[model samples]
Target: MLIRLIYASRAKSLGPMDVKDILESSRRNNTAAGVTGALCLSNGVFLQCLEGDRVVVNALYHRILLDPRHDNPAILDFEEIIHRQFGAWSMGLVSTVADNQALFLKYSTGAQFDPYQMRPQALRAFFTELMGNTRWLA
Candidate 1:
């Protein structure tokens, strides 16, 4: 069955090139694993949505828990979906750059993007809107 998992985590230490390295590795690894998703990094928090097979995604999430770079990982949403929202890309990076500030604030509860404070439905809505409007990093 196809499943989508949304999770939030704080970054242990975000280096200047860390996000770049993450995108590269995620694109490469997720492509081979048949996973598609978008990763958003803002305000020292990582909000990511991963979609794929149930067992594969579950295993992937568990592996993420072991990664030292991420801290306090929390699953925000998980459900079976009829189709993938990010089918075109293996892994997409969403940035909180200047142009995307307003977009991010729309769903944010305060001045910063805090997915942990967002409800599951709000998180789902955020991603649904994000897929079409946000400027993605390469």
Candidate 2:
């Protein structure tokens, strides 16, 4: 069965090259595993959605949880889905190069980047908006 796993984590010292490296690595790994997702890094937080087989997505999430590049990893939404929202991407990414604060404010109530406080549907909506936004196109 297919599943969608959404999680948020604090961002580390993620520079341009670091973001590039992450995107490349994720693209490669996820493509091989038949996973597709979009990753958004904004205001010191990362919001990502992984869609694939339950076992593969679960394993990938576990590896992500162990990665030391970020901390405070929290799973926001995890459920079986009939279709992939991010089917066009192996691992599409949006980093903090743009105005992250504004982006966060656009989707959230406050200026702070506390995605864990958002309701599941709201978070998914935010992800959908981000995925469709031209600025976040990858």
Any runs in candidate 1 off by more than 4 Å, and if so which? none
| TM-score of each model, in listed order | 0.96, 0.89
Tens-digit lDDT track of model 1 for 104-123: 78989998888899999999
Per-candidate alpha-carbon RMSD to the true structure? 0.9, 1.9
Runs of candidate 2 exceeding 4 Å displacement: 97-103
lDDT of 2 by residue, 20-64 (tens): 788889999999999999888776788889999999999999998
Clashing pairs in 1: none
Model 2, residue 136: C-alpha shift (Å): 2.8
